[model samples]
Target: MSSQPSCSQTTPSSATQSIRPVSIKQLQTLGGASGDDDAL
Candidate 1:
């Protein structure tokens, strides 16, 4: 809700740009989270 508007202020595309890389990094950090997806 409030957080969405905060990150999206600069550009509509910035929302995806900000989230995708960080989301991948977070999953990688979480260990088998990403690995499990790859294995499947």
Candidate 2:
């Protein structure tokens, strides 16, 4: 159904949103935002 696909898409969307900031923060902790793009 439509709801099934919406949920599937939203799950990854939410995860990516969470990871985007987390990745930057993690790289910042490791060193700096220099490798942020590469990390992603």
Task: Name the top TM-score candidate.
Answer: 2
- In lDDT terms, which candidate is top? 2
Cα displacement (angstroms), candidate 2, residue 11, comes to 0.5
Displacement of residue 16 (Cα, Å) in model 1 is 0.5
Whole-model lDDT, model 1: 0.81
Candidate 2: C-alpha lDDT? 0.87
Worst 10 residues of 1 by lDDT: 6-15
List where candidate 2 sits over 4 angstroms from the true fold. 32-40
TM-scores for all candidates?
Answer: 0.45, 0.66
The CA lDDT of each predicted structure is 0.81, 0.87
TM-score of 1: 0.45
Q: For candidate 2, lDDT tens digit of each residue in 1-40?
A: 9999999999999999999999988877777455675688
